[model samples]
Target chain A: MSDAEDVMIVLDESECWVLLRSHSLGRLAASAAGVIDIFPLNYYADGSTILMRTTPGTKLVEMTIHSDVAFEIDDFTDEEAVSVVVKGTAEWLDTRSAIEEADRAPLVSWLPTLKYVYVRITPTSVTGRRFVRGPEPERD
Target chain B: MSDAEDVMIVLDESECWVLLRSHSLGRLAASAAGVIDIFPLNYYADGSTILMRTTPGTKLVEMTIHSDVAFEIDDFTDEEAVSVVVKGTAEWLDTRSAIEEADRAPLVSWLPTLKYVYVRITPTSVTGRRFVRGPEPERD
Candidate 1:
């Protein structure tokens, strides 16, 4: 078990992006009708943008109305955890070429539903933190 | 590997609350200043409400301003996944009795920070879904 004195370290932009690219599962948060909704999704990191697919639902409608959204991914062990958050604007990839390229990416919905509409999030800010568990220091 | 013909079933409110009680880790989403943010948190299910603790930061500040937030908890295996979402309003537990009772709750911040403020979310709605993966049927 990890001690209770571990500290959380802030990750830089490059490191944050690296972590984002390394993970495939994330949660997408958007607001509609003054209510916030979050959905778990599988995504692909394409350059500086994040790509995901969704069918017609609250998430798609909310993103279309309010492009500003947040996506988060995290992995944890018993001792430590790393979390990355991306804040950006979401837009649907309506072009044929864009959809074709996104189809080739590794992103796929875990559910067996048809996720034809592709949404891209162009990140405005990317931040991350790594929580490191270690031995507690003795007081002098 | 499971086939690609799995189905997603919408769970009832009772089932959703059951899943929420089963999991302690979740992501909390809040919005402020036209930006949405998500934080990984350890929470406790208190009746129909959700309880968590945190130090002063963007999460706390945003929740105080907007109050409207989304909380999500999900569990997955190689073949299937279950997700639950809670949409609610957040408020700090300021009363002496409230603080004392909350202190005894199971909610604890994983990080080694002083999370003295206890926040409670009275859920407005609770929804859940279960993705069941299985063999695909033969095509005619």
Candidate 2:
């Protein structure tokens, strides 16, 4: 429930992580050169890190050049909406051990593609907000 | 229906615009300094631009510094998934006439907040992809 004044509530760190674990679909945004590119990704949140699979494509190449990226996920209903944003560093899981560990998670590309490259995002900060869905307050 | 080989198909320009208009919830990503930030927002797509309202905050401030931004929206069902990404420049609507015209849209803040500032994104390029949800292809 929301207070009368503030319809948006800031979620704690634990709450943010809980929301992250509950959803598998999200968007990853990374910048290269001067242009920013975002892609829809299906990820697995393991502990405090995010794991995803990508084929050798623009997403992997851009993140290699610029590790700093933003990942976001949101869920909405008729009564309330919640969103979580993660600012993190994305690194490819190159080691054999890392790849084996990532394989344990149920992470798979939504499309039937050959995605052997595993990428992990170590979050620098996680922020979330929950909004109570309702009509806007009247202007004075 | 998807072909037996390729599970993902690239959408054309007109197809992208139609998907953009079908949804109002999306994520906006903007970079300032060196870090990129993504925010979940509800927006109205008009003609060839996207219009959204926000209060004086980080989203507005960062866009003012670097107008270049990326916006993404996605939808998924049990059988298929679709995502659209727009790379564009964002500018705040300052003139009264511009604000008045935006007020006609069915755009409203999800929460009860004063969002008088309207920002519009004029896309330099739009890209979209549709994926048929299925299991990963077997390794050879």
Candidate 3:
């Protein structure tokens, strides 16, 4: 709307991945019964895949029904803002070996509930954008 | 996890609404062809409804196909965190009066792209959680 809002620049793929690895928290989008749902969860970025754990609930149910989902992470201060979105497919880590590896991941739940079920999202597309404020005019 | 993570408490419905009205930015989730998508957008809270504007894109197309969507807002610092989630139905304000009123809403796009189409989400469920750090014990 204003000149300040025109400073958003598209981020390259490398930039997107960097931002993803930098943030620990993000929102995961999944659909259940034709209704979309989002949950704010902590994630571990392992290579190109995003790893997270959740208990039995709507998130797990929707991921099981439909693996195609979106994951997003964003951060902003008074001066700058960055947002990254990953479109990917989710899979439950049911094997003993996979579960063992996930337990060693840096991702830790902030909630008191046990998040034992590990879900992995291998992204097909990664995109992001960054917004920065323009410099102010110099004073006389 | 540790005892520190156990400090997350579920906020009541009123607290959730209060937090929603306090924040301007949130993520909107919509599903298309069984694939879920999310977008970070700014919004205005009008009573029990969430109002936002967007250009014609995947988000608008998906909301048209299925109105059921989810909106989420959150804020956190090093010591505290708060998150609120709303599950609701999305509808385009096609009527002249609805469009006229929504144009005056406090919500404004931060991107250069034109966001003329106003959409309203009437939340059916609102939930939230707040994480606060417990007081540290005195050193021996």
Candidate 4:
């Protein structure tokens, strides 16, 4: 009934955005000084942009050094798995108006630490895929 | 009874390794052409290295351009969240013996696509943190 194929299915841009809006938690990837790092954080998908909050730490520093980043969210069951990736440019919401705008996005920190820095990632490209979980096909 | 603090707790190296071994799915982040990308893939923890299989695609191409990559795994409940990040160098298992060795790992493809390329990530630094999930602490 679904487009669920024998294996992998490519998801369209709209599907990717839908998945992004449905999930609040994701991994943020950024590179700094030749090393790339991934951190799991809470984020809000505001229209086409991804909003997140962070404190003065490695995550913020790395993104500051390199504006290019990738944010990913995924979910899976026994039968299927889906993943969405957004390659974007990250910038801190430094202006008062921008910070006030981000303050309303419902993005909250998981820990008790102060996360005064509001960062937003504007997507350069969004892509997604769906994979049907199954055993490997026998080799010829 | 546990070291579950009210907020965030830094996990030790041994604890990080334990968590890594307990999970099979993670996000691998790599940078290419000044843009970073993250992919969710199923992987096997072989001793201190991460083993995975993939078809010829963007994930493999980017990682080849920059061997410095980050692999991350995370899990969370309503009460707590834990994440482990491994900053590592990824190398394709091209040799006959190396590919044969990787074949022994309990790694299988989730899709029917031919994933002939086997890759291994050797960790340079492994770090983890545990966050006690709760509402933000009231400020003074």
Worst 10 residues of 1 chain B by lDDT: B131-140
Cα-based RMSD of the predictions, in order?
A: 3.9, 2.5, 5.4, 3.4
Q: Where is the poorest 10-residue window by lDDT in model 3 chain B?
A: B131-140
TM-score to native of every candidate shown: 0.87, 0.93, 0.84, 0.90
Best by TM-score: 2
User: How far off is residue B129 in model 4, in Å?
Assistant: 0.6
lDDT per residue for candidate 3 within B22-133, as digits (tens), equals: 8889999887666677888878997689998776554564464337888899888777788999998888878999988997777745554444577788889999989773
lDDT of 1 at A106: 76
DockQ of 3: 0.32
- For all candidates in order, state the fraction of native interface contacts they contain: 0.40, 0.69, 0.39, 0.66
lDDT (Cα, tens digit) per residue for candidate 4, span A1-140: 22225567899999998999988999998887676788898999976999987775555555654378889999999888999998888888788999888877777667665445777889989999999887666543
lDDT tens digits, residue span A32-135, model 3: 66766788888999768999877655455555433788899998876777899999888888899999898788775555454357789989999998977444
Q: List the residue pairs that clash in candidate 2.
A: none
Q: How does chain B score by TM in each prediction?
A: 0.84, 0.89, 0.84, 0.87
Identify the leading candidate in terms of DockQ. 2
Model 1 alpha-carbon miss at residue B56, Å:
2.9
Q: Which whole-number lDDT from 0 to 100 does residue B100 have in model 4?
A: 86
Let me know the DockQ for model 1: 0.41
| Cα lDDT tens digits for candidate 2, A1-140 | 33334778899989999999999999888887767878889899976998888776655555644379999999999899999998888898888999888888988578766545778999999999998888766644
* Full ranking by lDDT: 2, 4, 1, 3
TM-score (C-alpha, index-matched) for candidate 1: 0.87
- Descending-DockQ candidate ranking: 2, 4, 1, 3
